[model samples]
Target chain A: DVKVTQSSRYLVKRTGEKVFLECVQDMDHENMFWYRQDPGLGLRLIYFSYDVKMKEKGDIPEGYSVSREKKERFSLILESASTNQTSMYLCASSDRGPQETQYFGPGTRLLVL
Target chain B: QQQVKQSPQSLIVQKGGISIINCAYENTAFDYFPWYQQFPGKGPALLIAIRPDVSEKKEGRFTISFNKSAKQFSLHIMDSQPGDSATYFCAASYYGQNFVFGPGTRLSVLP
Candidate 1:
């Protein structure tokens, strides 16, 4: 079975602190994504990587950055954590195809104090 | 702006009843539509999906009804049970730039 594992399930950070959320996939999918889920906002993409060392900005990419140095790992970074960044972050991976389904990891709920 | 919009932030249905959730999209280039089911403390899973070429697709009790002309699609859960209670999201993608998801509907199946 394909599995996407997140490094942390819950995290708490102070304002202005830098944070890292890691995601690793075992299926060797070429495409990986980062999204933040709010109460009524659904899942909005923050960033996505099509290949190793390649990244693209999603709809909401401000205050965030991504790293895809390896094929199996993708990481989301919060430059300066704020209260507004407190949300459930989900990571996903998929094959490099237009009509492929993405497999998501158990999300990380981050709270910024 | 939200490319896809979903209605009824929450829904309540009794066991053996039908549960329906609707979604509308703004992009015409989007050709692939998928519905995801998410449980508490878990990732969203693909429940059912449909393509623009088809009007409807059914996988057992879960069905996706698509209206190509109206740019609307819906998920119908027949004979809903308690185990079916969860959040559902509708998503669309065009040439796979990225898959955009709906706000999601929280469904509660009563005993």
Candidate 2:
């Protein structure tokens, strides 16, 4: 089974504070992704990492960044939390291929004040 | 811009009923289409997928129907039980790259 784990189930932060969300996958997939889910907007990809030290911006990458220093772990960083950035963050992993299947983590609900 | 559109923001079905959800994509370049199921308080999971080469694909109770000419696809759940109730999202991609996701459809199955 493919297991993806996020560091937090819930988080609360005030404006201007920096926040970090971590994710780990045991399957050793080559591709990792970060997405945020909002009502009516669905899920929007924030960033993607196909290999360590490499990253690509997704549709909604503004105000967010990602780091992949290891194969199994990916981290999403918020430079400064804002109310508009509050949403459920998700992490997903997939094997390296054109027919890859994404396995998602439970998600972290973040609240910004 | 690539986009996927889905209809019927919410649905209510009785037990042992069939649930159908529709999606349409704008980019004809999209080759892979997948449906994802998300439960409350949980992340989305891959339910079923279909490539443009096949008109239909089935796995047990879940099925995907594709129409290349119309740029559309759909998911049908047979004998939907309460456990099948969740938010479903349809996504399209080109060889699994540059995925574009639809809003979502929330399904409720009553006992």
Candidate 3:
């Protein structure tokens, strides 16, 4: 079984603060993704990394960035957290191809006050 | 480009009843359709998936019905139980690409 771990399950930050959400996968999957889930909006992709040091912007990447310094770890960074950034953030990792099934972490519920 | 529209923002079903959620896609290029189930404060997990080549696929109590011509697909949960209550999402993706998820339908299985 794939084990995806998030650094924090719950977090609260003040406005304009820099926030980091970390994700680690034990399966050494080559593809990792960051998504923010909000009520009524479902899951929207924020960023994705295909390989180490490789990153791509998803549909809603504004105010969000990603880092993939290693294969097992992917981190999402909020340059300046705002109240609107409060939401559940999910991290998922999949093997080589995009068609492969993704294993998701429990998710981090971030509250930007 | 890639958009998936889902209906029934919320649904309620009695135990042992049938639960259905539908979704339609505008991008004909998408070949993979998948359904995900999410519990509160948790990430969505893949429940079942189907390819355009197949019209239907079943796993346990979960089934996926696909219609290529209509560009639509649906998820059916048979013998629904209270434990089945969750948010379900339908998604479509082309081969080896990012999936576009629907708005999602929250289902409540009352016992």
Which candidate achieves the best TM-score against the true structure? 3
lDDT of 2 by residue, B37-97 (tens): 9999899999999988899999999999999999999999999999999999998866444
lDDT of each: 0.91, 0.91, 0.90
Q: What is the interface RMSD of each candidate, in Å?
A: 1.7, 1.8, 2.2
| TM-score of every candidate | 0.92, 0.93, 0.94
Which residue pairs come into collision in candidate 2? none
Cα deviation in Å at residue A51, candidate 2?
1.9
Instruction: Tell me the lDDT of model 3 at A62.
Output: 96
DockQ of 3: 0.55
Residue A7, model 3: lDDT of 99
lDDT tens readout by residue for model 3, B3-94 = 89998899999999999999999988776788889999788888988988899999999999999998889999999999999999988866
Name the runs in model 1 displaced over 4 angstroms. Answer: none
Sort candidate 1 into its docking category.
medium
TM-score pick, better of 2 and 3: 3
**TM-score winner between candidates 1 and 2:** 2
Across A47-82, the per-residue lDDT of candidate 1 in tens digits comes to 999999999999899999999999999999999999
- TM score of chain A per candidate: 0.98, 0.98, 0.97
Mark the regions of model 2 whose C-alpha exceeds 4 Å error after superposition.
Answer: none
